[model samples]
Target: MSWFSPSRLVPSRLVPSLPPYSGPYPVGSCDVELSAADLPSPGSPPPNAPATIAFRLFYPAAGSGPSRPIRWLPSPQKAHFAAYARFLGAGSLLSTAVSLAPNVLYYTTIPARRNAPLLHPPGPAWPVLVFSHGLAGSRNAYSALLGELASHGIIVVAPEHRDGSAPMAFVRAPDGGASTSVSYQIHPHKPTAEVYAARDAQVRIRGWEIGVLYAALEKIGEGAEMRNLDPNLGVGGVEEDVLGSFVGRLDLRPGRVAWAGHSFGAATVVTVVKSAYYGGEEMGGPFIPARDAGIVRQITKSSVLALLDMWALPLTSPSAEQFFEKQLPAYEPGGAGGKAVLSVLSEAFWRWHGNLNDTKVVLAPRTAVSDDDEKVEQERRGPYIFYPEASAHLSQSDFGILFPWITGRVLKATEPERYLRLNVRAILQVLRENGTVVAGYSPLEGEEPLDGGGEGKKGGDWRILNPEGGVRGWLPVDMEVTSEDRRMSIGEETGGRNDEVRETEVLGDVKL
Candidate 1:
């Protein structure tokens, strides 16, 4: 069943392309890295002095010519492999074994073509999404999800957090000297005051890094030359001005670009969006206010927010009380922000009652008990929330697809590709309802690509987002998780994060 012998086959051969982008357009990818000095800042750089900002751009691209596929592990494959092994808690022996197969990783490539030109959509410009990776995640961590979104005509700018969250990174110097090799920074699994402080520090750095990325997008829209750190980058349309075509093709206008992330990355999305709209130098705590650049204006109440398995602990730090106290901008006084916001959790997180309660508390107003013991309920449009059946924390990410055997056989997480498709469908539908002009794929039952040409009801994937409409095991979640339910969940499963799971995995299926 493989190009090589059974024993000789590797992870790359098992899962060649990143599940295949189920959309109308071809996806193209490029690695762009910039330091503070390289950025064309009209004003001063962001605070926290983030050394470098690096990410992969996955966008709808011109499919005419031939292109080499970008490798999944990037350049210096051995280092990336070892770093991932360590991040996953593979012992020294397993880590060395993983590093020994650098060639295996080199052969593995996602479906996207390398450096292909951006496709010219019918609209003024393509909607953009600034995606943040979670702990043990790189730019390509959520390729299956982000790349799929790009295939449907969205430009996804996925940032690699150099705040010691990834396995390893070779950050380029501002002056183009030898690259700085940064490795993963580990914090205790326990949620102690010390852990909270460390996470807050990381969150601040992550938040500021996004501010710098926003500035870079602003420059790219103006046709500015951003010196990408990768020396071996493939030329797409021409050798020079690789980023030229995006001059007027990117929708970088205020309140246009969207925010998204997974796990800790999801928390980053919430914090940054909250900071952009509500927090400033005047209002302070650990929140990195968005006065640094255009972030304050770019991210508004109307901006679409898609959080997948948001890790609540980072937002729970006592230092961030000023931030956690405020409701999501979606609930902005008389604003239609709720429909655009969505949170898709894996079954694993839904079962972790305490974290589930915390996640709900942040996204929407919770049920309050009156002195007379009656539940107080109001007519509020909370962010659409749901969980796919038989899914794990890593299900929304590339980990499930890239390592199918581990996630499937060992972990019993069935339908990795299907669940991701479900997620893509729901998010795309939410985007559609939120005013983004990306093409809608047909219903999930057919698992079709983006609808070609004619606009019809069949082209709308809105049913997937509807609570009454049936999707593949995507059940409408009860937004109001009660105090009694949290107590019961503690008895059913461990109410803590494991290795790196936002909500630590509990083995058996407990009926929700």
Candidate 2:
């Protein structure tokens, strides 16, 4: 009878909930794919074909309508996940189970309407955010965060990279054939240079895709005919209708646009920004082809950039040098007004990478100022580093929040509400600095002062480091005083040790 109870081994209820959005407007979502024909392929000889880029758009909707059921994992994506699991050495049984029933472990419905009407009389077109997903991650993995942004009147366009970085992507043929899912293969034990080469190539293709999208948006703003600009775009797919709805509704104003990414995607953001400012070949090296200089200049001149826990900046090689030296210069304080940059890092990143020793050494010298410098000269010029104490690398995405039980094996469980509040606050600060929309709700209103003077340390577990004095000058926050050696002891209280008693006793002082 006990053996028949398999429910004890495998819990029936595993679906996780997404944190509710704290915004004013309803959210809507749509998907689109754009194709650019006869793009130059540097390494490949002749017969280079066109490039196709897929994107998912999340935006504010007109009214509160019946929400569409968003699939947690689409059919093709499930296959990709299975392949990815196997590639990462997950057991075959677990991989097959995950592939067969992804919906069983996660909530299937996303809180967004599909193809809902865009808010009409559009009170000023919404600001744009171009998001890049991490390697092997699809556009929908960050749906929770993207939906929240959209609800706050920010249009989020997430591009799905097709350069063998994504686990799988649907590639449509020009000859009207059915779309096919191409699963990217990962070569085992590749050399460091080869890995960097592959990543560089992928990032270049992503940059081009972004340039093409920006060009299309500019044309749309100029009221050019969409079909005439590219015949292959918005045709023969479900995305066609969605792309049609975006005409005349995008806000392409300079400085209002933002580019954000996580992990490898963050490297892409840095590369794109640097390439746009400097020449592509100069910033990305000889392996990378130059982009349209005009388009690159237009996009980079006024975009807010956010890098979410970027993995190893060195992965981009020469481009990484450009990012640290020329792109993110620390001597010029006024540069903030031009390209406002924000970097959000998790505690796990610091712990695993020895408190970011390499990064600190690279950035410290560039930001050091003279001790006798004037007040105005001492103003911070570099990116603000936001460190959330209880977070991990995956904290920026829904994966950590949704599957806490599984993720907790590697990292401590995060308080989703606290995490969201910290993220939203940091993002709002960057937006305000960039002169974008300011949040109606403020996080600093009723909070105690960060300095240790006010009512103790009750605010939160996060810190912001300014680059003016480099890593050594990290601002201090109120810290709670606690006993060091408070150990729990269990003892038998009753005669002859009949009953157990537990007590906590304080010993010597201990620093956390």
Candidate 3:
């Protein structure tokens, strides 16, 4: 897929377009809701009330016609547009005006067919990937990436977690009546500590929500009835449908499941997996408690996990030092090839410090773990670390790809390539290492070349390096690439704020 041309960045004439999926299969998508009567809310909600999870499912399609385009934003109604416009820092009048103008509000199209037939691959079942969005992000926020993965014969399930963390989510009543749209509210007066505590709490709740979704899959695997549940609980513009196609089509095999998340969602994956590995009490943090230990254990026991530029590591209690030295190296073999953890981070991840100002704070120094430590785990786990230099925190989602045109600022506009490469690498790594699906491409192909050069003999603009040696011999590269601190300062004037943060603050008072 070709990168967006420079001419398409004009604000008045720009129409955002997602790059085509590189996989051979066409993509099919549907929305479904899961209601677990026994699942308890992690936070202070009604205990007996059934915990509900609404998600969009993307999978490979059997037949291809003119692709069905999906709305970029979930709610295209005037009310939602006004709220989102305000959240984006538009003035009241402009927000109202933009809401009234439907053309300007709903312009982007996701290149996937809705309610298309699910394609059965050569295997007995399709590999499953559960995706969690970042704070204030919707399930469709990463539509491009998720759709790409789905096109590659992977089933991508993204839950619309309405734990008061997303920018907006359609909250369905327990009785399956009308769904109400909820928007994120900013409380600037709330103490910083209180805010952190609330975020940590939400992280745990979202993690448990993931567990509930997995349980639903298990039920489907057992041939349980899923159509009896409410199917009209639509999110954004997409309506929920019957689960008849997905009933026997899902691959719930041990080690075939992979967990992936961005930002706080990434942190949630880590928390849940860590709690399962070491008892919740031993990990001692605001969110990891004994109550969630069982759920975490069940979710992470045999699943491959991936963290995309995690934002909650600093706020968590168990240090990476403790996790790497004790749990990571001591990982016991399981269905997912001994519990592998792959983190595809961006350069700007190191500069993040919540809403505070500390550009030099290293949130994930373990990316540069010692050669000895790397060697120990290399044999057990696959390449445990990868960071792309030409990317930011939002690069993993559609927002990063479209932001350049939205704001008319061309900083790091080539990030779509970086995101595409890194995302494919992460998926391929998990699949290849777990012995689920092995394709021809190397997981490390097309990464940003670290050496000061253009394309190398390996046909990748970036270099792929191994901890034991400089570059993989198969690539035929000459230079030795070592892990370096990719963290960069935006200068004292910016006070550690990346472009994404600065842009968000400028658009609205929301603290993400």
Which lDDT values do the candidates have, in the order given? Answer: 0.72, 0.52, 0.54
Stretches of candidate 2 exceeding 4 Å from the true structure? 1-14, 38-50, 75-78, 91-107, 120-123, 187-191, 220-245, 280-294, 300-302, 313-324, 329-334, 337-339, 358-380, 442-512
Arrange candidates by lDDT, descending.
1, 3, 2
lDDT of 2: 0.52
Against the hidden reference, what TM-scores do the models get?
0.86, 0.73, 0.71
Relative to the true structure, candidate 2 has a C-alpha RMSD (angstroms) of 12.2
lDDT of 2 by residue, 1-512 (tens): 23322244434355555765667778777665555552222222112223555677788777554444555454454565565565434443324434555655433446677766566424566677888887666677778778887776677888877765666677666456676665664632222566556555666566666666666556555555543211222212223234445566677764457888876677676666655655544454422434543345455444677766665433335545555455343224544432266666665554433224333322222444566765424343345565666665666777666656544544563664455555655565566556676334432421323544222332221223223322221322211112221111011112221111000000000112
Q: For candidate 3, lDDT tens digit of each residue in 1-512? A: 11222234334355556777666678877766666564434433322222567788888877655433466666545555555665655443324444455454365666777767677677777888888887657777788888877876788888877766566666556666866665665533222555555555565567567667776776665667664333433334454343666667777764457778876677666665655455455655434434543344354445677767665433333333243233332144332322255656555553343322211122222233346765534434333555555555556777666554332233343546555556675565556556556233433344334343423333222233233324321121111222332222222123433434432211222221
What lDDT does candidate 3 reach at residue 153?
75
Model 1 regions more than 4 Å off = 1-16, 38-48, 91-102, 235-240, 290-292, 366-379, 443-459, 481-512
Per candidate, the number of residue pairs that clash is: 0, 1, 7
- Angstrom error of the Cα, residue 170, model 3: value is 1.3
Q: What residue pairs are clashing in model 1?
A: none
**What are the per-residue Cα lDDT tens digits for candidate 1 across 167-233?**
7877887776777787887776566888887788778778878877888888888888777766545
Least lDDT summed over 10 consecutive residues: which range in candidate 1?
503-512
